[model samples]
Target: MSTEAEYVRIDDGVLEITLSTAAKGTSLDFAGVAAGTAALAELGADIGAVLLTGAGPNFCAGGDIRDFAAAQDRSAHLYQLADTLHIFVRALDSAPVPVVAAVHGWAAGAGMSLVCAADIAVGGPGTRLRPAYPGVGLSPDGGMSWTLPRLVGAAKAREILLTDAVLDAAEAQRLGILARLTENDEAVLDNARALARTLARGPRASYTSIRALLSRSATATLGEQLDAERDAIGAAAGSPTGREGVDAFLAKRAPDYSGLN
Candidate 1:
């Protein structure tokens, strides 16, 4: 699976998505979007977790500004580009397994959007995030407008994007953008990979249920959320994965979830 993938690799039940371009920087160009979409689509139920990272200093620098600048019809080109990028972004959002990101250096524009969509983001001292769209005379894409407010609240998301605020590692962690912080910038990716592997060894169905319930809670009334949770928990408790987890707990042994998910 890894050999056929242009920007993704699957190993030890974890899919690592390397968002890197030939220039050694992460950019949401046509190739990157297409590669990411295909990689995510092909994973199916083969993996238990997805890890997102970059190949260079920055996680993602944003869109391919050079391509956008060179386009004859900038409006039409940008519209199509953004629309396609959204498909990849939505795949990350709706992935059955957990999505983790190793956010280092700069996560600007679309990069920041990806960080927002991640279930868990690991960063380091040098990590910085910015909503760079306004600087390019554009609005948010990749569901940034929707995910940011959920992470940092509506007012803060508004201020951050409108003012183009740059969030350093500490600030981003405090604001819940980053779920974990490593010792330094270089440790971010390694730590995130370890976390993804750890999650891959757990109950995949439970994780999916948790992700779905939390996402639904964003707009669900208290009663609605309670009902949803009840249904999810009931289903999980009756699943094969759930039975193995319980048996392992009672026997004080490690659960083998390898074939369960």
Candidate 2:
């Protein structure tokens, strides 16, 4: 069958999720939401890593305003949209494997939020991210309020949201929103793929555990976080991969993580 709102393909242990509505600049609607969520869930079933990107120059241009205009109550409509976005963001945040976003061109509003939700993000040097909510006479949604502050602190996040400023890849990197910045879209995808490969070959359980810990640590108290770390360590130590890692260190050889399954 032809791809739906977008396309999802898995190869070489990596799942590549692409936004396919290039004519619309990948603008999201309810159909896009359903398709994207299903694609991501399917990709997570077997893949060791996921790479999210767009098929055209723009990663995404945020919600399709035309769809928004069709709703009866704009406030309720926006809340529904935010709820849909939360489902997708939570899936990415809780995925068992690493997620890398390969950003190019414009990543605005919810698109930027998606990039932030990824475990690692690489952007093209020419890529631009805009907090476009205020510009459109709307407030931030799709976990932007939560993720942005964590990445750049409250002051900078407030400035971005209040002004709806567009940030270049270099500025995004400086603010800790982007993991790496490259000269072109291909380079950004290449770097993300390389990083995903490395993560895929590492201790999968340990990586998942650490991902959970770090994502939750932001709002946790120091003592609560310490307890979480202790619990996570104990759980990891009980895993077969952990034993293999210990044996490898003592034997002076690389761990056979393929046996983790």
Candidate 3:
């Protein structure tokens, strides 16, 4: 709704969410975080997947230092900003529809956190992800600490967080921070969109169930995870999409998943 972010319902159930700040640095202030949160919350029932990207040169440069300095009550100002960003990050995790981040140039601080929150990330050749918090005499926020450790292991995540390590596209990909890489920014977004479209057409219940299991894996014990997986798989098997897939296989025909939710 604001220039901070643009929300578009691209046909075929894909929601294209792009950071829209025109600033050269492209850092998000409090308003931008709130705007993004609102945009994500507005995803309708018709929407089946989301593709997140950036406008112009860089993806995002993290918090706008200028905005922070200009605030009269810096502490309260930051509290509000972080709170809003936290909500957006939580929404990304709980979203029924899967999300993909199409990242290029820079994804710093909260920007990098957003990428980490996505179900998948596609990075462009020029992508460089880093955390700007340590450089600013602050610590990581927006779930960066939690996401990165799970992503690249605790030792590497500690090095990244404490040392302001910059992860180039290749390194990020190798570390599993990026799901795929493209030759350029356009290709990055294009690939992400294609992935989103495919996900949109997939069995909704199965996709959501898989996401739910993964979300709980970190805290769940082996037995707990096994139980969760068993339940999820059983539910999926009973779903219309699952039945249709079985019937299609038996008939030697393409499954009509269009009948699924």
CA RMSD, predictions in order: 2.1, 2.3, 2.0
Model 2, position 60: C-alpha lDDT score? 70
From the highest TM-score down, the ranking of the candidates is 1, 3, 2
In order of appearance, the predictions have TM-scores of 0.95, 0.90, 0.93
Candidate 2 vs candidate 3, lDDT winner: 3
User: Given candidate 2, what's the lDDT at residue 5?
Assistant: 38
Clash count of each predicted structure: 0, 0, 0
Candidate 3 lDDT by residue in tens digits, 1-261: 345424444668887766535554677544555665676787666777878777667777788888889999999988988887898788778888888888878999888988898999998889999987889898888899899999999999999989999999999999999999997766877788899999888777677888899999999999999999998888778878789878999999987777477
Per-residue lDDT over 1-261 for candidate 2, one digit per residue giving the tens place of the 0 to 100 score = 345534666676777777435766577544555666776777543578878777676777788787788888988988887898888787777787889888878888888888888888888878889988887798877789989999999999999989898999899999999988887766877788788777777888888888889988888999999999999998788889889999999999989888484
Off by over 4 Å in 1: 1-4, 22-24
| Model 1 quality (TM-score) | 0.95
- Which candidate wins on lDDT? 1
**Cα lDDT for residue 190, candidate 2:** 78
Report lDDT (CA) for all predictions: 0.87, 0.80, 0.82
Judged by whole-model lDDT over C-alpha atoms, candidate 2 comes out at 0.80
Please write out the lDDT profile of model 1 over residues 82-172, one tens digit for every residue.
8888899888878889999999888999889989999999999999999999898999998999999999999999999999999999999
